[model samples]
Target chain A: MQMTKQEYSKLVDKKSPPSKKLKNCIFAFLIGGAICTLGQLLMLLYEKAGLSETQVKMAVPVTLIFLACVATGFKVFDSIALIAGAGTLVPITGFANAVLSPAIEFKSEGHVMGIGAKMFSIAGPVLVFGLTAGVVYGLVLSIFRLF
Target chain B: MPQRTGHTLMLPSKPSVTGYAAVVGKKEGEGPLAQWFDKINEDTTVGESSWEKAESALVRDALALALDKSNNPPSAIDYLFAGDLLNQCTGTAFGLRDYNIPYVGMYGACSTMALTLAQAAIYVDSGAAQKCAAATSSHFCSAERQFRQPLEYGGQRPPTSQWTVTGAGAAIVENAGPGPYISAVTLGKMVDYGIKDANNMGAAMAPAAADTIKTYFEDTNTSPNDYDLILTGDLARIGSDLLYELLGRENINIRDKHNDCGLMIFDLKKQKVNAGASGCGCAATVLCSYVFEQLRQRSLRNILFCATGALMSTTTSQQGESIPSVAHLLNITI
Candidate 1:
């Protein structure tokens, strides 16, 4: 009826299925690479259209995120995510899903509290720190440019 | 420790399930068992501002339908045994607050339905109450937010992950109603089989289900084949397979009539649910809607409903703690 934590752990470990680490790793690698390649293709297409470097940089992410949102709306992205695992999480689309899904799910809750508030739930921290880093880089660059 | 036989509790008087109701969200409504459920809310929000409120409304809608179907006024109910996959069972307390009946909130995670029914049966059999209500609810959004990642996170679910059934089920048991009766109940003991993967709940809970069902068969001296149907809650595919193998080793072949609410609640082939449907409502909805309909009509008999639960908190799982799971079995017969 009673046992040490170690004993209990042993009991649980004895019954659990063995992990397929090699298979999981291979899938994560392949999928992660694919998602990144898709993002790169958007950038390449923007470059071919003779867009300015700044416009291309902005347009690429916007297209990738929009595609991710569309795939999520169609319920196809989650299917890809099922197999890709870390590959999905590592890509920008994964972040897009994080921002879009909750907002969409809680859409009925109203804009202020639902979309406005929850849209930033998972990706908020990333946005905050990322923007802050960008601002810091811009400020340092501007100061050097002036010098 | 006299080998702990006779753990089974036979009723003093036959307890009958007089009324029941099941409700779910649109996703579950799209499942194969859609037609069987009493009601399905088209939107996950249920016209509520927050996920918690939506869950409370699910319990409210389900209990209202159950009480209405039973043809009993709210005042006729003696006590309400209710719970949900929420902290302190807040969903239960909040959902049923409008009702003046005495309430007893319980928590067995996903196993709340069977646990409540078993207790409600015992109370009725003991003449503690002429009519008692047993209810439980779970919302996908609420449970996901509480137990795992917020749906807003849109986290990638593992193949082992199960979709939580966003619904509520309510049933009223009485002494002098209908033919199908609660004959016996076998409460399970907490068993930790050291499964640490929070994503793979079926694996974590399979051993506990095996242990409970095995002990139930041993104590009652009943064979699996003797029952027309045996159902386990929320084990889905993986856990159900393990259960089959566990029982098979003992020469108990239940493949002919065995069902998992998880697998039954959703059409895994068509639905994206990798493992199957889960949550407290998983068993509650399937059993209350489909199973109860069958039993009430005398289409089938000798049903063993065992609801399984994975008892772990966010903190515990985050701390790398192994899951402790349990199952409660209620033998229903006509």
Candidate 2:
């Protein structure tokens, strides 16, 4: 009861079972690479379809996001995400999942309150700072051009 | 050992668990304790349009089933103690509204089940309430959207994360009944071990569970061998192991007689639940179904049921704060 913070922390720290980091890293790398490779294949397919470069670039992420949403609806994304972690999370699909998961879960709360309000709960902070930075950079560029 | 042990209330009046009910959704129905549950509905909608309403329905039907099983009318009950994994405990508020009984809405997160049992025992013991019902519920859809991720999102679960059980359970305690009686109770204290990650709830709750278990043993002058089983609520695989280690360090071995509600209700291998099942209903469904059955058949006697809860909200998690948790215990004898 009188234990110091360090002692209490040490005790709590030891409570978590040891995880297989090396094995996990390998899985993350392999799965992440596989997803990226699939993305590349999609990009190639779109490019070979006589689409413009801009269209192909846009189609790749949109396709991936669509696929991620589909996989999530099927409940198969968690297994893949489990292995690839950042490989899935660092990509656009991760953001899609971040939005989609909570939205569908709270669909019972109604669209406006549940989906609309919480749609950005996960990614809102990132969006806020990202948009702010973009506006600041745009202003700086415009100021330089004026000078 | 005398009934009045350390930090525990000894009920000399002999209150009993007269009736109980368990209602679970599809996934829980497919779990290991499928047959033990009183009602298993594939349609989680429960004739309702919304998930929140469906959750309310789950509790209402569970309380009704329990009263029917006990052959007691709703009007006969004196008090109703209930809670759920919902904002403002609205799940219980809306669900039990039609019951028309004096209600005490509580929120102990996952630990609400045992907390209710302990509180009910106190009332029944002192002759304040002749018959009282305690219920707790959790819906997978409701809890996920509120606490974690969206249901349809392809987000990966951390190795330490647990599945929130979609279920509800209710129990009736009476002053005179032919059932398992409440012998004692050991209340838990809030314990924070500085764990900030919300995904690893088992770790956050294990310390409180350990403290409560140790205190119960010390107070009752009993050990692992004294009871047929020592059950902890919703700790699952990781938290259960942590509890084992912590108790071992304290030199009180419970590994032999210890079990967890999270691990009991589901087959981890088949369910693919990362750590195990959690939520307020985790302990409720297990206790009302499986544990109650065993106690009914006289196969188990002098069992300890301790439900644990994580006291953290989305607001706290966003602010980068540690999860504070508590565990409440009940000593039941058949």
Every prediction's TM-score for the first chain? 0.78, 0.83
| Candidate 1 local lDDT, A1-147, one digit each (tens) | 223446535544454445456776788899888877887897888899999999998998888889889988777776777677677777788898888877776676688997798778778888999999999999999999997
How many backbone clashes does every candidate have? 2, 5
What is each candidate's fraction of native interface contacts (fnat)?
A: 0.29, 0.53
- DockQ (Cα-based) per candidate? 0.24, 0.44
Quote the positional error of residue B113 for candidate 1 in Å. Answer: 0.5
In model 1, the Cα lDDT at residue B326 comes to: 89
Off by over 4 Å in 2: A1-5, A18-35, A38-48, A69-84, A132-147, B1-5
Q: Positional deviation of B203 in candidate 1, in angstroms?
A: 1.9
Q: Would you list the clashing residue pairs of candidate 2?
A: A101-B150, A101-B151, A101-B153, A102-B150, A105-B151
Interface RMSD of each: 5.2, 3.3
Error of 2 at A27 (Å): 4.7
Tens-digit lDDT track of model 2 for A8-112? 557656655456678767877887788889999998999899889999999999999998889887888867887677778877888888877777766666889
* Candidate 1: stretches off by over 4 Å: A1-59, A62-88, A99-147, B1-5, B152-155, B249-251
On DockQ, the leading prediction is 2
Q: How would you class the docking of model 1?
A: acceptable
